[model samples]
Target: MGISLQKGQKISLEKEAGGGLTRIVMGLGWDAAKGKSGGMLGGLFGGGGGESIDLDASCLLFDEPGNLVDTVWFRQLRSQDRSIEHTGDNRTGEGEGDDEQIKVDLAAVPANVKSLVFTVNNFTGQDFSKVENAYCRIINGSNNSEIARYDLSCQGSHSAMIMAKVYRHGGEWKMHAIGEVGQGRTAEQLLPQIKPHL
Candidate 1:
């Protein structure tokens, strides 16, 4: 079983997996909160329903100096070096499992790259209070086994969350659950809030 992480908690990737973690996937999932009234027409006509909740998952690559070197998100699905790639974007959190997934090859990561930050934002401008059963999980790419998971349990008025970070620690990679809340419709707007967490 994988470790359940709390805010600001950190764990070694290699240690958790019992071996080197070369390739990994950061999976994010969530469910849209039900409207105060009715099914679909009620929400569309009188309540907050029918409208899709567009949540975007993003990965920011930072160098040793904490400077952003690259990004992988909906618009830009692949990094320049191709070390990271976003599987695809999920406009609504209506699916069964992961709404969005980002794959990373640790061995292929550039020497200068030291940190990869994962973030999620409500592109539709809906607050997290309208989102339920949200979680971010790390999975071993080779065997598809979960290594760690962080649950976003608290509902907030914010539209964005800095979910987690995977960084190099003493020649080994470590993962940290950040869980910081902020206001942003896109990843670019969350940069200011994300840097502080790094």
Candidate 2:
């Protein structure tokens, strides 16, 4: 589970509280690509498949401004569902380079969403590695204004996991980035860290 989206659970990023708040953001990053088999671990203790986890994948935003596309690269993954899935692999330098961003159309959002869940996946099975300062922020929307920003970065690992963020600001429902790193994959392991003492 590790901060994941369950069935019948939809996070709403649309601000209908008369605040004119609109827009959703998602970003990803990774370690620097130089040594260690040119970014990704070359020889491992497993199978030999899948594309290289190195290099950068261009960002794709929906209903965005002109000539303002392709925010950055972060070795994004090709998984189930593009817009909703946030499992990207960035095997590059740590700290900072260029944050990868993706935007969604606020007006085009579904009406069944109550909150938005922002998930990140960058487990490369290589200890002694670190991933720092990776997250997403809302930029703009229908009212020509910006909303709140979320922090989606955390410690690094070598397995598949997710961190979900649900937010409620000023009587408005906003999924402010709530990503986290855990031991295993399960809602039980993550729910505590996310909504502890609840």
Top-scoring candidate (lDDT): 1
**What TM-scores do the predictions have?**
0.93, 0.44
Q: How high is the CA lDDT of each candidate model? A: 0.88, 0.38
- What is the per-residue lDDT of model 1 for residues 1-198, given as tens digits with 9 covering 90 to 100? 699998999999989988878999999998887763366634543466555678899999999888999999999999999999999989988979899999999999999998999999999877886788899999999899999999985687899999999999899999989999989988888888888766
**Candidate 2 lDDT tens digits, 163-189:** 444344455555533344444222223
User: In model 1, where do residues sit more than 4 Å from their true spots?
Assistant: 37-50
Top model by TM-score, which number? 1
Window of ten residues with lowest summed lDDT in model 1: 36-45
The TM-score that candidate 2 achieves is 0.44
User: lDDT for model 1, on a 0 to 1 scale?
Assistant: 0.88
